[model samples]
Target: MIALPPELLGQLGTGLWHVFAVFLRVSAVVTLLPAFGERSIPVRVKLAVAVAFTLIVLPAVPSPQSNPGLLPLARLVGTEVLIGMVLGIGLRLFVLALQTAGSIAAQSTSLSQLLGGAAADPAPALGMFLTLAGLALAVLMGLHIRVAEFLIHSYAMFPMGQTLSAPDLSQWGVRQIAHSFGLAFALATPFVIASLIYNLALGVINRAMPQLMVAFVGAPAITFAGLFLLFAGAPLILSIWADALFSFTLNPLDSGR
Candidate 1:
């Protein structure tokens, strides 16, 4: 059996503790991250991904307090977990924005009930499409690297083991949420406007041609227009969403974005 010296043992224990603390934070983030945290993914796979991320980030995190006792370490773990949750929730807003946009667009275009089973969550069909597209685009654009950098940058804004400021965090959370909703509306605006025009024109036609079955004629017309609008507008909508997500990833603290 190999025997370790006292000083080496202490150092090894501290190192392990630091890694474990980081693991807690990473694990919390992985539980709610966009692609990795999808409902379709197994919890075991998520745990492995979190551990892998912790290993990658462990070397970058600062060391733990000197000779910390059990209680302090436990509190530290709790703090790290909270921080991870906060950050994960903040980033999750991007996906929420996409979902919101999809729901709005789908409703506007009267496609809300079609393909409703496509999403992991119970959302409208357009929401599912936008979420899937946005997530796929993010992954294609190297979301994992950006997420790692976001985590590393978070340590600077919020050192581990420190109490997170409630007021500031709340304000930021609210602002981010409002911005997310704005993004959703912005993405879906084109569809909404098109819907308004179609409805207005249909109303005029129905008034002028009351003898004709306008409801039957307009339903197919609106549906066809919705499909065509989606075909033409999806790329642009996804591109705008991706830009906002990248901006948020690169600079979460920048409210100007």
Candidate 2:
């Protein structure tokens, strides 16, 4: 049997440890990242993606020597997971923004409660359509590559084996939650306005013709209008969302700053 040099073996061990740390963080983040982390994807495929990304980011990530005891190592791994979750949860907010926008749009147009929550979330058919379309669009635009780059750059903001601040993380989380809801309401504003006008028109028409069966006429009109609005505004909506996602990917800390 041939024996390897101690130096080479030590180097290999260090490299493997760094790779493992990267894998922990990558896997955690990938489990929640947007298109890659969607319910439609298989766990094996996601794990494969995490491995691929770990390989790419290994060179850029710094490996600090630490106490290799079991308890200490476990704590480091847990910290990595927490960092990954914070980064991932930031992007996840954008997905929720889309969901909220869809819900509002569906409700305003009376298109709610029609599909009975076909998707994972309790969203209307319109919401489901918009979300699926948005996700597909994001994937087509090379979301994985953007995410990999984001991970590589994240080291600057969140270093490995570093202690995280609870107050800072909490503040960031609150800001992200507020922004998500704001974006959602902004995206759905147009639909809400149209619905308002639509309802007002229906009220006047019904007042003029009490027994004319306004439900029959108003329902179809709002439905058709909702579909048209979706068709027309979807591109703009997705464009805005993609811009925000891409921007955040490149500079994850800018939102907080």
Candidate 3:
């Protein structure tokens, strides 16, 4: 191979730092996305995914201004990391919608207490279902393509070295939290209605026969009915949820900075 000229070598060295910044930014987002972010995924797999994303994205990302000094390089890296984190966290909020729905469904069905133990994530049974559903839907929807598009658009909205404002972060967080609650309620509505009718009927039985152990009789019946309702309603709910998640993940203005 022919040797690169000294001037060309200098230019290459200067551009390398910019490439590193892009890699950091892209990797950060990949490391936080659902399937890749989960603790179940091996670190090696996550790293590989991140690396692949970085390579693909680097060409599209605008190069950072060349900074010869170490401090500027450090600052560039930090800015990229921050941008990545914000993007990741924003997308992660959609997952919370599922968790919230699951928790609501469990509580409404009176199955919350019966759940074996606290999940590592400290979610209720409904929340667990929601999480699994959302994750599965994300995987099925081809998350990698959506995420790449999101990242590309993000660069246009919140380019490198531009720190997100605190107020912007606060607003985004609050909006996401509210959306999570709303999505959960929407997902659990059918179950909630079924649960209400079941409980009201159980209450009537208790009043009619005070001597009978209504709680024992009602619990098993409700559990079986709830399972059936879940199976029947799950497909529609998951479909709606997948559509919502796709919209949220792809929304260019989601960052709202």
Query: lDDT tens string, model 2, 142-211?
Result: 9988988999888888888677899988888888888788888888988999999998998999999998
RMSD of each: 1.5, 1.8, 2.7
Clashes of 2: 0
Please name the candidate that would achieve the greatest TM-score relative to the true structure: 1
TM-score of each: 0.94, 0.93, 0.88
- The alpha-carbon deviation from the true structure for residue 179 of candidate 1, after best TM-score superposition, in angstroms, is 0.8
Q: After superposition, how far is residue 10 of candidate 2 from its true place, in Å?
A: 0.8
Pairs that collide in candidate 1 are none
lDDT of 1 by residue, 1-257 (tens): 99999999999988987888788888888888989998888989999999888988888999878668889978888888999998888778889999999888888888889988765567887788788888999899998998898788778887889888899788888899999999999999988998899889888998998898877888887788888888899999999988888788778877524
Q: Write down the lDDT of every candidate, Cα atoms only.
A: 0.86, 0.86, 0.78
lDDT of 2 at 84: 93
Please give, for residues 1-257, the per-residue lDDT of candidate 3 as tens digits. Answer: 99999999879976787678778888888877877787778899988888888777778887777764787767777887988987787677777777777777887777776563667756777677767876887788898888877777778888887878889777877877777677778888988898898889978998999899988888888788778878899888888877876786677355222
Off by over 4 Å in 3: 1-3, 113-126, 252-257
